[model samples]
Target: MITRLGLIKTSLIDYPGKVAAVLFTAGCNFYCPYCHNPELVSGPVPEDFLSMEDILRFLEKRRPVLGGVVITGGEPLLHPDIGVLTGAIRDLGLEIKIDTNGSFPAKLEQLRPDFVAMDIKTSFSNYSRVLPSGTAAEQIVRKIRESLKILIGNGIPHQLRTTIVPGIVAEEDFDMIIPEVRGADSYLLSGYRNQRTLDSSWAEVDPYPAEVLEGIAEKLRLAGVPAQIRTN
Candidate 1:
């Protein structure tokens, strides 16, 4: 089962240059303290989740108006029926973007989404700090690195997103990431907003200043990576 947990009927901003509907899948492998969707990640699945039939019917009705669909998660690739879900959405004549944590490069290559928005969370050195306790740090990092290679090597339209969390990511961390995504086309530095975080302590933490984010973006630009700071 795909186990869809939530759906946003319409969004002007989730998918770049397209009016899209966002579908949130339940469950994730990572246990990021800064995650905003804790409910979808570790909490109980809501009983009111829109069934695949319901989602498809709605998409059919909004076909003329919606330009695309964004399947985000708790890590969308974690679900076994992801390819099946995407196939149905693709049949609707709308582009699909899957938001993921870069855990499943093979699945992504197989699905061949129109666009992929993958989170870089933190520098590879800090993976153990961000991932769930007891996770194989080396293996996961290797997988993430492989995912990046798969996207860039295949020329898949993708964006590498990094959330500018206060304590989790510092100014120097970008230095470590610069070489990793040197040839990337798009890099988004998302401003962290502390709201209902997975770790309650993080809710009291503040985000980096706008200038701090700009500085990080500048570093990426200087390293030959096209970067943008997204406040929203």
Candidate 2:
């Protein structure tokens, strides 16, 4: 149903123990400034972006070379046909991993990916910015919470992540996030990198100090989350 977008042939971090092809679906529901894939975010994707057919064909060719496919976004769940895409990938007998904002519980169930990466936005990331003040914020947060619960209760292979933006995300923020995602297998503290981002402000803003990040990771560890820090 949703066929338009770009694809990355490989990613080492997206899928463990496997060479993976990463699909970047167009569009998103949130406006996190540190979003690395700006082109896929609010910006228009290339007119020459590969079709879903082409992607599947490419995956078929890369089968022996790649272990699986990582279905990522601009909030992949925002695409209405995500389940169709994942179902096709699953039919290939290659594993499917989905990277989402955790904003679509029903879709997550429909896809039933082998792995899921859920972004836990900070409380400081209030609704007025990334989310619309109208129905968007409450609707999106409700879905995100439901998705988290489904992932946790169903025993899915998943990790909860928070991108640590220096001024935006504070150390105490984890106090709220960790408890909600306590049983997650992995809790990732991804340091915001400014090499590229949707907004120019991100490139200008200094990242959180490693010490601060490490301190948050320490807090996460104390919170009983098996946390790992990644600085880029």
Candidate 3:
């Protein structure tokens, strides 16, 4: 029984060019400030988890109209049963896209989602403070990097993304992340929204403009990293 906080029936935005339903799972491994799903991040999972029957009912009803399902989360990898959920969805003959922080490569290997979108936190990502002290942070990143290699080398239909938190990252952060994923299929430079954040300091900081994001994306593209600039 996975804890679910929200569900969007159709999202052109989340999955990008696909007509898909987005299911927002509760709980996250990291507390990123710019995270918008505070209803999920700021609280405990409800005792009444969303039943598979309900999800299946809805999926069956919309099976003709919708293309697929996109399972996103604070961190879907935290759930041991994600593979079960996505496998069930695949049984309905629909494509699946998973959005993750890339923390659990082993679990992800089991899930085998049709497409995946991974968030690559910038160097400014407060590894020490936001993440649970010491052990958890390092291990999560190691798995993320390893899975990133697997996804790229095996030609998974995936995209890598990094949210631009203004004033947090400069030119140098790319130096750290780009080398790891230099020739990725697609890299999305998303502009952070100035709203609810886990940390109060984040609300005060402004987000970078679209042009600045484009400049950064262009630089990455020039460095042999294929990416696109997407601002909302």
Candidate 4:
């Protein structure tokens, strides 16, 4: 079952050019230290988590005001019944956007979302730093690569994003990432927040300044990738 952990009745920034409802799902494959929604990453779903029916009912009522729905996580794609959830949303005539880590290429290819935001945590070579110890980092990297191809080849409107964490990702790493997402529709560089991170120690780390991130985005644009910085 897909666990519906939280919901934002309305959001203007989560979905581009639309006033949308945001659904938060539970569970994640990667354990990035700077993850802000650490509580949703693992552990049992809270007793009060809304049932799938509850979520659909809520959407039904709000259909008149909402332009779309943003299904985010804890990697929404991790849930086996994610397609069912998306299908239900689509039936409401609401556009759907999914936020993912791009770890599940096969599953991603099965669903058609109006928009996709895939986090490129770091260079594929350094993915081991965020994943579990027993994970096959190389294999996961290959899957991410495949997912990228699926998005580009299918002509999906998507953005490749990376949070500029202090130590986890440096400007140099973009050199490796550029080759992987060279032809992506867009590349987003987000400033990291140091609070409520998955790893408490990450709170002590400083994020890159806005100018620093702007510089990096400029570099990406010069290299032929459409790059933008998201401050929120």
Task: Name the candidate that leads on TM-score.
Answer: 1
Error of 3 at 152 (Å): 0.4
Q: Is candidate 3 or candidate 4 better by TM-score?
A: 4
Rank ordering of all candidates by TM-score, starting from the highest: 1, 4, 2, 3
87-169 in candidate 1: lDDT tens per residue?
Answer: 99999998999999998988988998999999998899888878888999889989999999989899999999999898778
Candidate 3 clashing pairs? none
Off by over 4 Å in 1: none
| Pairs in steric clash, model 1 | none
- Pairs with steric clashes in candidate 2: none
- TM-score of candidate 4 versus the correct structure, residues matched by position: 0.96
For residues 118-206, could you state the per-residue lDDT of candidate 2 as single tens digits? 88877533534555335467677778789988898999899888888865678887777767777778888888788897878789887
lDDT of each: 0.89, 0.80, 0.77, 0.89
How close to the true structure is residue 109 of candidate 3, measured as C-alpha lDDT? 76
Q: Per-prediction TM-score, please?
A: 0.97, 0.92, 0.90, 0.96
For residues 32-93, what per-residue lDDT tens digits would candidate 3 score against the true structure? Answer: 76676665664777555466668877888887887889988778778877777888788889
Q: How much is 124 displaced in model 3, in angstroms?
A: 9.2
